[model samples]
Target: MIEQPRHIKSIPAYKPGKSSVDGWDGPVHKLSSNENPYSPLPSVIEAMSHAVATMHRYPNMAAPELTSLLAQRYAVDEHEIAFGGGSVEVAAQLIRAFAGAGDEVMYAWRSFEAYPILVRGAGAEPVQVPLTPKLRHDLPAMLAAITPRTRVIFICTPNNPTGPAVGHDELRDFLTNVPERILVVIDEAYGHFQTDPSAARGIDLFREFVNVAVLHTFSKAYGLAGLRLGYAIAREHIQEGLRKVAMPFAVTDIAQAAGVASLAAEDELMERINVLVAERSRVEIDLAIQGWNVTPSQANFTWLELGDATDAVSAHLNSRGIIARPFSGEGIRVTIGDAAANDAVIAALADAPRPSA
Candidate 1:
């Protein structure tokens, strides 16, 4: 038998959401993935249509135009921006560039499910610090867990699954105590959804700290998940390191055109964000009134602490044609979709009997 690497053997395959099932004729609302329910901005769609005619030629390997637009919008120099397939790919590149077999990569447990997996895949050891009682990253504990082997630390503000974010002051304090050599990755994929004034905006921190790299994605609020566009903003040196590991022409021409156009439609996109934020507040209030333990979410999704009942609740929702992400022993995460989809989820929960008190 051909020998497979031990590391590859131990890694579990990523579980993507199921799209369809036999005999399921009911209307399916997929809230499993935190995707934008609104339509892609008209400007983006028009740009994509125009780019389709030029698909014969290879895309720009450097993504100069897109990077230039991003630099202008984010107020960073063009040399400080690097584009990738998505924020996930950028995460992988960061690991490959800075971390190695003996190096340790630290992040909060249950923040982004892919963090540990990506870290391990890059031949690095993953050190996951447990979240605090309030379901936020225990920065102090994570800082204490760091060793000389530590190379990179991922901080997912407005964190995944459990939806609270670390405050700005807390982040500044944490960075102050962290060693200068360690690279800090602020993965703010959901940053656009955050409405709180105190939430840590990765770009703001990236401007202040030379060691920090901030990753953002068009996959969430921009409603371009299918286009697979994301970018990282960092100091020039860090950006160059990321570029070294990036796959050539990884972002397609259509995606680049779409991204440039979408940036131009920021005002229209913000209107859609306002809608999601309003709906999220409504969902949170309704869930709380119904006696479910809904975490105070600052992102585009809400997490319910269903405990062992997680699987059962998830199955019930699926049966009703509503898909949610069940985090096994952790809990269930439901994305805040359009009003109708949100209503369907709440209605299903209201219909199901509460687990014994």
Candidate 2:
């Protein structure tokens, strides 16, 4: 076999959620990837249709129009925004731009599985601090994990796999302790679904801390996951680095067109989000009554700490045509699907054996 870098060779690949209906004969409810259940807004589809005619031309590598739209929407300078295929690629850019061999990139373990893989792929050491008992980031512990070589830290609010977000008070306090030289990334991929009043808003934190960067995506809330568009807001200097590391022409013309159109349709999409939030509430409540140790979910998905029964229960869900993201022995993360699909999830779980701790 050809030789490969130790770090790259050891890195685990990102596992995408499977389709629940893959092997089933009946209609399937895909609650695996936390994607928007609603189809593209009428305006977005029209924009994408219009963009298809321009496929012969190379996409604007600068992403000028989309950047302008985002800057106007956020009331920030265009120079401060940098985007890539998705938040995941943006995270990779940040890691590549900042950390290198002998440096360290840190984040809470079980937060986003991509964190370690991305960091190690960049030849940087990954320092993972374990989440709290309630599945929230332990801010104080994260602070203690910092060292001179810690170049970056990722804070995934409304943390994935486990849904509780980091509190504003704790996050503000934690930011004060972190050295200004370190870049702190607030990964808010599911921020729109947040209903918690105390949840730290990344923009607010960004305004306060020069080193802080906020990541947002058009994938989850805007129903554009397939389009693969995301951006980061950081200080001018850091934004420069992100732009420097960006893969040229990574964002397609259609994606850029769709992002602008989706933003224009924000009001309509938000209405859809409100429904998912309500559904998330229902899912959590139903899970608690069903005896699953459900973490209070503030995102579009609910997490079940199923312990040893994770695989068996995942199999059960698949059998019922409910595709969910399962972490072997750890837990299962189910995306809140459409009304019919959600109702099916509740019914399936109700009918099957409860997950054993």
Candidate 3:
């Protein structure tokens, strides 16, 4: 029998949302993962198809073309950017690079589920600051939670499983107060779906702050989740740390080709995003009409603060063939899927019993 460390054993495993309804043969609308409902653009698929011929060859470990284009796009030096299998992997790299046992990595509770897992994987203590009553990151409270051992802080904007983004003014103020030695990572995996003009842009903040690192993913808005590619932008030293810990050739050639194609087809992709944004608006309005008060979302998903009624409501939605992401006793995070999927969720919730007061 293997003896696992208590720290590793105590870490709660991340449970992903369900993709299918049990024993239901009808059309299933999976709104569990916050994935872009649209298929990859034809150009992207074409690029990936072409790259398929080189499957036998190892990928460009440096990903020079993708890095060069991203550097040009973000106006950062190529050395300041690093790539990984996903933003989550890049985050793991960041944690492994900067933190270890006895160090603390802080993030808001009920944020991205992977935060604690990643922090613990690196043998760092995870300091979870609870969100405000409104389900938003409480910057002041997070500041209060900081300690001398704090090495990394992850701020997820338009935070996962909840929809509100940290405002620019508040974030700037928070960054100003944070010690310059502590690495503050702005996780913007959902940034492309963000609509609020005043929301903090990590890229803009990266230029202003030396300790800041910005995480981006092609998984969400770019519809590249299947290919698994994400990147980070930060100071050269931080980028070097991430690169040092990154898995060799983590971003495959097919994924790199798709990334290149995705950038070239941004205009068309943005048009698709516009459609999803409109659908999000529709879902919010319809949910409100059905007597559910939802937090306004700038990201591609909407959150329902179901409290004790979460399990029941989730079951009810499952009965209707809608598999949305439910966080047990907490709340449900429903992806703003296509019109059909959104309508199914709205209709299912309309029939659900009101959430506990």
Model 2 Cα lDDT, one tens digit per residue, 1-357: 899978889998888888645577777888889999999988999999999999999899777888898888788888889889999999999999999999999999888888988999999999999998989999999999999999999999989989999999899999999999999999999999999999989998998999999999998988899889998999999988988888999999999999989888889999999999999998889978988789998888999888788888888888888899999888999999999999988988886656653
Instruction: Give the TM-score of each candidate.
Output: 0.97, 0.97, 0.99
Best by lDDT: 3
Model 3: per-residue lDDT, tens digit, 1-357?
Answer: 998897799788888777878878889998888999999999999999999999999999888899999999999999998899989999999999999999999999989999999998899999999999999999999999899999999999989979999999899999999999999999998898888999999989999999999999999999988889999999999988887888998899999999999999999999999999999999999998888979999899999988889999989989999888888788888999988888888888888977766
Please list the residue runs of candidate 1 whose C-alpha ends up more than 4 Å from where it truly belongs after superposition.
353-357
Model 1, range 194-215, lDDT digits (tens) per residue? 9889999788888778899998
lDDT of 1: 0.88
Candidate 2 ranges with C-alpha deviation above 4 Å: 20-23
lDDT on C-alpha atoms for all candidate structures? 0.88, 0.91, 0.92
Candidates, ranked, lDDT:
3, 2, 1
Clash pairs, candidate 1, are none
Report each candidate's C-alpha RMSD, comma-separated, in the order given.
1.2, 1.2, 0.9
